[model samples]
Target: MRHLFLNGPVQNGPFTFATRPGKAVGIRLAAALNAILGLPPTPHLWNTVTLAGDLRHREADGPTIPRQRFEADLITDKYPPGQFPVGGIMTDTDAEVARLALEMIENNLCAGTLTISRETVPSCRACGHMTGTGSHPCNACGSTDTEDRTGLHLVAELAKDRPVLDRSDIHASHRQQPRHLQNTAGNVAERLILSRTRDHGIDLSPHGLDGLVLDPRVGIHVTVLAAARRHEADTAVMTITENAANHIAAHGQHFREHGGARLQYALHGYLPYDHTASLQPLHEAYRATQAIKESFETWFLPLFSLRTKTATSPEQLPALFKHYMRAHLAQPAEVNAAAFNAVQHAVGAGNVSWITNKQGLANVMAARRAPIPSAAGPAHG
Candidate 1:
């Protein structure tokens, strides 16, 4: 599995560890105890020590002390000036024990780890190549001076192995930080850099057996990455909507009559979040001429109205107009001119009649057969 090793403050949602030493202590404790107990050890005891109860308490011989302090006291169980010779090995053994405990804690935190995105990609003094993988000699210039980097390849690998994705989205600073393990409050700079670098041109693949290496340099250009991500997200969403439309077109008329709101909701979430940027090229190559916007609306609206048990929202009117335009602009589809005319006519400008009635036609014909209007108001017949 893709493992992420971070050396920093651990923030589990609302809870935060006050000190780094606390984290170190926990890791060291886990490691030491595991070694002493042997593999496949009993769980009840380990759970009791590490997770169940607090171990920092003084023996009934003295004043109460914190668990850590009490544990220390046990090793140095001495006081005052002693006139007798003491064991040489007992000199400051408490400090040694504390140090060992910390090491064990660190080991436990990192045990069984196949690969870590944070440590694999180290920062360089020169060009920022955060990913651990680099061409043996720089591929760009065939020089040995090139640095390796990492990014999405690691994320992809983690996804494949199912590492219980704690957090997929991170701020730019979090990405830049080497030990971005907290899964929250990460280095945003690193994320943006990696995203941009990859966007320009970079292959991101995991670098472990059934896992991937993540590079930190990929955070360079966030704007480009965001744009690309949005495009891709949009395309996928639209594809689904189009498929829904196609299904309705082929299967039955009910969807065609009442599916606008459903389609709207789908597009609402899909469009802004799409990842693929270049859609026009795909459309042109396929010679697609369907009015997707209108089709989507037609399918969604009726269904939405039925579910809500109310008329369409007034706010939706403008959106419908925009959809109408999008549906008609592309070559694959044609808007119904009659329907458009009817709506326009309801407004003042289009209400005038363009056609002449029979009486008007007759008057025109008679006028051509007779003389023009007289000067004195009206001439005698």
Candidate 2:
């Protein structure tokens, strides 16, 4: 199976990796997994189709710099200087993603899964922003005056045959399937609005829904598939948190599969990055170097999150740190082929138990320093 892991497109919000390392967890996880699999790098995904993005752009040189350029600039700043991504960056509204989204929508329409229907939605009278079903003031333009407006919008009728998220929709081993997440994600409304009035997005003008754009939730799925299609990956595993997965699962119902490719969410947990500094004492005791500490925080912890599937508490950091140091100390002079192959297969099979094994971690660390396998092929990230 050709599997590619891609980070769920992060919102182009105000935060850098240096300040909020949590934001880069998904990106780091994807890169680490792809490296282990001997697959080329995959493009990092970004979500620019947001109302906050519109207001931010307008506030900061609206006419001077393009929104795309604005979002790209912010993403670049998130990376370290001179260490830009080798896989490049793919935004939600990229031309290729837009084209593929429209094509997918068309196919869904033909299959009667999606429709162009007239919807009476509340809109801000000031900026014409879709305020949604709420009595509160508009998020955009801060307008309290809202009125119901009728327009042709893209709508999706939730299928009755299956839940929004099923076991098959998750990238997990049989024993680790998240039944609770599956139940929660399927709790969305039966009918969904797939179009929004965002300033920057995959425009639906081509479908005659003028001034409307594809909802970011659906665009997120398309962005992953778009990246997967580029790499010729049949199975695209999107690294995301369970909370995020539940939020977008319903909207992505019809967007998960297209042509011969399939998209699956690999649920990961939250890291207590704020508490990492407290591990300095433990670091000293273990004689852990800066390199070992950095690796444990950035790489190992993200992989550990895949196993935990929920918030890893601050109290657990010290033990986790000690575990990592032990693995670092156990690193062999060379990677054992048999051990490395098992680790690789575990990754491909969505099994993460090997992550906590000391010997397994040592073998993986050694494998990272070795020459790339001939099967790794050319740069694709």
Candidate 3:
């Protein structure tokens, strides 16, 4: 396949989408786009390799469970019972992801783009966590006491041939390129330490960097590529926010591509899901059902965020809901192949204008309602 949309692996923490809809924005956006393209639903990517996860596991006083099982259980609980992701879930710490990360590391090392070198880095005196260079308290244990720790570390030697992120690395068209992000994401040191102190991660033990793990920033990219590789997708488009893309862009410099597959960031914005309450009046006016409201919030707003790129304010909710109502009203009785093809072209071209265009939106809605043709043709047609 040419392009497959995947979420920038979301951090698996103790939060539900019911409580924090914003966190699921990337996942929802990816699902919406992939559905439009008629691709099999991509696995929901998750980031479970955080210090907080380590702490959560340590603090739990129940029957002992493996770290991988612990994270998987937590992720399963995040979704409603039997409402799990259609394509299932893949985490950063999954064996598939670990395998891919190691493969990429070895390849980069062979290509001289990465190296195992002993370097001094600040370490938490209490917990042995890499505190990085800052004098601030350790992120893991929150202790200010630290010491310089030197050991074999995985170091990434960024390419000088091009910026960390460029137009080709983004899923947007040339006219919609994120110039600011392209410039800012490159603002990092020439060399980056890709190894980190974590209880559980893609261990670099094979490379003699025992006890160290690949950084989550880089693992996140691997998570996407692993999924893409499974689907045989040549290009994996990760749905992420501009801020998130900026944060991981540097670390993912070399991890974005593996084998013949490549990864690109599709920048989206924050949605004021908290303010969706304000749409109740409009919902009542349009006689929106519970499912209709969900479609607007979960499906439509996420696509709109792709265009908004900043923040969708509460004040805009009413108008956005009204626009959706109009599109819903315009939904055709039968799916129009020509109109739907045009919408697909727009999506593939990184043009999100059709999201707000009533006719285009209706065409998409109609397509979603249309029955899928069975592999053996309609059973009773």
The lDDT per prediction is: 0.24, 0.91, 0.90
Candidates 1 and 3, the one with greater TM-score: 3
Q: Can you tell me which runs of candidate 1 are displaced by over 4 Å?
A: 1-117, 122-125, 131-143, 146-381
How much is the lDDT of residue 340 in candidate 1?
29
Which pairs of residues collide in candidate 2?
41-381, 42-381, 87-381
* Model 2 lDDT tens row, 15-116: 988899999999999999999998998899999998889988888855489888888888999988988889899999999999999999999999999999
TM-score of 1: 0.16
Model 1, 178-272: lDDT tens digits are 12232322212221112112211122222231222112111111111222122222111011122222222111111111111110111011121
lDDT minimum window of 10 residues, candidate 3:
372-381
Instruction: Give lDDT tens digits, candidate 3, residues 135-157.
Output: 89988988999999888999999
Question: Which residue pairs in candidate 3 collide?
Answer: none
Best by lDDT: 2
> In order, what is each prediction's RMSD in angstroms?
31.5, 3.2, 2.4
lDDT: worst 10-residue window of model 2: 372-381
